[model samples]
Target: MTRIGIVSRQQESDLARIPHVVRLVEDAGGTVVAESELRTADVVLVLGGDGTILRAAEGVRGTDIPVIGVNFGHVGFLAEADPESLADVVARLVVRDFTVETRMTLAVRVTQPDGSVETGWALNELALEKVERARMVDLTIGVDDHPISSYSCDALVVSTPTGSTAYAFSAGGPVVWPNVEAILIVPIAAHALFARPLVVGPDSTITVVMNEMGFVDGELWCDGRRRLAAPVGSHIEITHAEEPVHLARLWTSPFSGRLVAKFKLPVRSWRHQERP
Candidate 1:
């Protein structure tokens, strides 16, 4: 029997659907398990939006377990199914009818002035933003040990292709396809003329050094979940993580279709095209 691990939001409305989802899993000849038992499960079923899915991914990081998201919140970008399709999704899982998509992740390390290093991982983007509202942060960027540029900005985001559509997109970075192995660096409200978003190869290492003369220190945020202090003179190194986030996909639709549907982009021209 398949053991399915479930992780849901704590909201009252989100909690209300757990029983129905559990019933579907049970009827499909699967056993339901808590998030703590995720490592032992065949797959994980996440109930919520993209944030919930991120949390689930963090829990199963470095493991072979795959995650399938069911949309129960606004902007379900990572979710593959909806509440109404829970029964069908469960049935499909039982029959092993799904594909797994491996998404690139980032491994971040912050080296403090005292020589101690802190590390974390992010499936989305790793952001270094100013903690003081009135002061901008000074940052020096580097790639593969070569100095790139120095600038003052509200924040800087180093994201994987999988994260390009998240914080990077909102910060004016290009939307990169998930299949692409690359990284995106976007500057938030930069004060320099050459401040622009950059896309680099996956094997490259990106570094950000916080200037010691800055008014205040910045903060490091990993996928908006893990937080750490980035003091002045601190160095942050970002590189592709060894393991990827495995997503269980039930649909064969191309990523282009998913992007158009998720953003509600007008594709009427394609639909109206003439065929010979």
Candidate 2:
């Protein structure tokens, strides 16, 4: 018998469907387990929006356990199935008819002025934003130990290819395909003329140095889940993580199709184009 781990959104609406989903897993010859036991299970089924899926991913990071998400939130970009199709989803899991996609993640290391270092990881993007909304933060950027640029901005987002569609997209960063191996850096409301988004190779090490002349403090956010204080004279280093998150995909639809469906982009003209 296959052992499955189950996790759900904390909202009342999402919690109401957990009992039904648990029953479906049991009927399919799979034993349901708690989220804490995810490493021991064959697969993890996440019920909720992308936030819920992120939480589940953190738990199974660095492990081969694949995760499948059911959309229960407003934007289900990461979710592979819907709540209405519980029966079909369970059937596919039982038959092992699915593909796993490995997504790159970012590893962050923050060195404080006192010589203490803090580390964290993010599947989406790591952001450095000003703590005071009224004041902009001064940042000096570097790549592979070489100076890149220095400027003042509201925030900076260092994202992986898998994170291009998240906070990076909203910050005017290019949308990189998931299969691409790249890193994106976008400046939010920058005050300099040379402020522009940059895409770097996967092997590069990106660093952000906070200027000590700035009066206000800054904060570092990892995938919007974990946060740390980034004081003046602090150094933030970001690099590619060795272990990537594995997502179990049931459908073989191309990424372009998924993009159109999620964003509802206008494709009427393309649909009517002449075929070769």
Q: TM-score for each prediction?
A: 0.96, 0.96
Clashes of 1: 0
- lDDT, candidate 2, equals 0.90
Across 1-276, the per-residue lDDT of candidate 1 in tens digits comes to 888889999899888878988998888888898888788888999999999999999888889889999898887878998888888888888777889999999999999888889999899999999999999999999999999999899999999887887899989999888999999999999988898999999999999999987878999999999997898899999999998999999998888877888888886545555799
Report per-prediction Cα RMSD to one decimal.
Answer: 1.5, 1.4
Off by over 4 Å in 2: 271-276
lDDT for each residue of candidate 2 in 1-276, tens digit (9 for 90 to 100): 787788899989877888888899888878888887888988899998888999999999989999999888877888998878878988788767789999999999999888889999998899999999999999999999999999989999999987898999999999898999999999999988898999999999999999897777789999999998898899999999999999999998988888888888887645556789
